[model samples]
Target chain A: EAGVTQFPSHSVIEKGQTVTLRCDPISGHDNLYWYRRVMGKEIKFLLHFVKESKQDESGMPNNRFLAERTGGTYSTLKVQPAELEDSGVYFCASSQVGLFRPTYGYTFGSGTRLTVV
Target chain B: QQQVKQSPQSLIVQKGGISIINCAYENTAFDYFPWYQQFPGKGPALLIAIRPDVSEKKEGRFTISFNKSAKQFSLHIMDSQPGDSATYFCAASIGGKLIFGQGTELSVKP
Candidate 1:
């Protein structure tokens, strides 16, 4: 099966500009999650989607960031008025809901590298 | 606490030796622990995992030793190879969300 796919493998934008990252999860996977890792920092969760419904979004940094998973398929994360601190690698992961899956079935995308200057 | 602490920030090991990375968490509610390996330009991928019920789990050249009482876990790479050089992250899972520790970069010299 094709793994999770993320578009715009790399992006660079000026401060206060807007940038959007896309992720297409594997078919039949019901759990989708977004994470970000700043330079020299650990990867941190941003949000989770369970079939288009947000299960948790506490990790979202602020109002400038928005995430949406439409139709329970692909997901988009938009950073409006991007700041220098927002520059990081955005990763999307998916997992199938099952009791017998291997290691909870987490598959991560290659991730989109965002740079704000 | 929600954080997972990891150290040392980086390591260098000779091939055919062992590489160890340690992590500790303060949340006892965490029931699952997993280690992820990431190469440059790639997202993290699961290397191995262990539950609180097990003190140790090994796969191939990878092993996860869990210390539930101390709320700590470590990843051991046996017969470390140059290919095993990468950034490794330790994460604790609770309610399907992972709390990750600072990553450790491992370099194995051939």
Candidate 2:
């Protein structure tokens, strides 16, 4: 099925540098999500993983932002000291459970365009 | 608190015209209402969805109109083209965790 897949896509980094964004879901997907968009705004939510725990991170926006889903399969978002509003565009999504299933569509990932300068 | 509220941030239909976009939500327990379609760099995609017992839900030319007591929801794009422009999001969820609406930049002009 291979859909959600993110990586370097684009990243510039500078301010206090330290960036890491990667996602590779869609293989038995257990639900993994993280979103951000801060150019003009509107695309929030920043945490959620169902296999490596962390069901929700309450939309993490602080603590230098860090996210990881190690054993549950692909996911990582780390922005240590990066600032400059931490640039934006970092989306990773996945879905596959069954509860509200409607073919469970939620497979975004063509994002990762952080340019914190 | 901005649960959702989308409107004419941008729109300019023409090619066979008929493109409407609107959204309003404040969490009525939200019953799934999705509508996403991004293009520029790509990310969103799921162009049509509706729930709330269904007030409407088409697919071909896209349509999703649900109004559970005015919680509002809409997205119509009948014959528009120009590849149907892009950027349009209106979301709401109850169990899958979604809550967006501040996008709409459809510019379908032939």
Candidate 3:
């Protein structure tokens, strides 16, 4: 089985620009999560998806950020008119079903570093 | 308000010593507590985790001590090595959503 994979590894965009980050989770993993960590801060949850349906999005910072998982497969996060504060690494994680599943842990991608200059 | 609080933003320990990181949570509903380790430019990986029902769980050199009454938990790294140096984060999970603490940067010297 392959691990979670993230694209570009790093993304740089000017302020107010738009950037879309992609995460391809492990096959058969039904739970996908998105988190971000700004410089000097701990990683924070952004949202979660269960089989293409959003299970929780309370962590979404604002309306400027949108996440989607189509067909219960790979997921994408789009930041429109991104701001300076949005500069950080966006991490995507995937896990098997069941509460406290994947006893080992959720497999996390290397993450896409988004820098809004 | 921050749901979780971790202490000693940074720590240093000699090789073969012990590295302890502490965390406290405010949400009583949080039943799952886990610690993560992240190297530079990498995503965090689970180190050890414990549920409120158990007071402790050990995995090789890593151990997690949980205190449900105090709503606190800690990670203990025994025989610390240079490879153990990284940023450690304590998190509480409720309903599958994880709330992380501020994080602690641990440096194990050779």
Candidate 4:
């Protein structure tokens, strides 16, 4: 089976522009999550999806960031009016649910490096 | 509010030596601990993990020593090789969400 996959491995855009990142989770996985790491910073959670509904979104940095999972499949994270501080790597991860704390571990994509100039 | 803290921003170990990285967590509710390894230009991958019920877990040349009482854990690489160089992160899980520590960059020189 294939691992989690992310598109546009690297994206470069101007400040105030918009960029959309896509993630395809593993097959039959109902749990997907988004995380970001600014330069010289630890990876921080952005949001989480349990199928089509959001399980948690407390980690979203601001109103400019929006995430959606359609049909309980792939997910997209959009950054609108991107700021210089938005330059970083975005990673998507997935794991199965109904386990005892997801012990099987999460499979992460290679991540998309977003550079806002 | 960083829930997890890792030590030694960077480390240099000679090949065939032992490499150790330490992490401490502040959340008592966290029951699952995992270590992630990331190569350049790649997302972090799960290296190994341990639950509070176990004090130690080992896989191949990698080992995780978990101390639930002190709320701390560490990754140990025995007979480290140059290919083992990478950035490592320690994370604690509440439910299924992970709280990651600041990463430690390890370099095993040949």
Best by DockQ: 3
List runs of model 4 lying over 4 Å from the truth. Answer: A100-105
Candidate 1 TM-score over all chains jointly: 0.97
Deviating ranges (above 4 Å) for candidate 1: A98-102
**Model 4 TM-score (2 dp):** 0.97
Q: Please rank every candidate by lDDT, starting with the best.
A: 1, 4, 3, 2
A31 Cα displacement, candidate 2 (Å): 26
Top candidate, metric lDDT:
1
TM-scores for candidates 1 onward, in order: 0.97, 0.34, 0.96, 0.97
TM-score of chain B of 2: 0.33
lDDT of 1: 0.92
What is the per-residue lDDT of model 1 for residues A1-117, given as tens digits with 9 covering 90 to 100? 999999899999999999999999999999999999999999999999998999999999999999999999999999998999999999999998753234557889999999999
Per-residue lDDT of model 4, residues B1-110, tens digit only: 44899987899999999999999987888878889999998889999988889999999999999988888899999999999999999998876888998899999999
DockQ of 3: 0.71
Check candidate 2 and list the clashing pairs: none
Clashes of each: 0, 0, 0, 0
What is the interface RMSD, in angstroms, for predicted model 1?
A: 2.1
lDDT of 4 by residue, A52-110 (tens): 99999989999999999999999999999999999999999999876535465588999
- TM-score (C-alpha) between model 2 and the true structure: 0.34
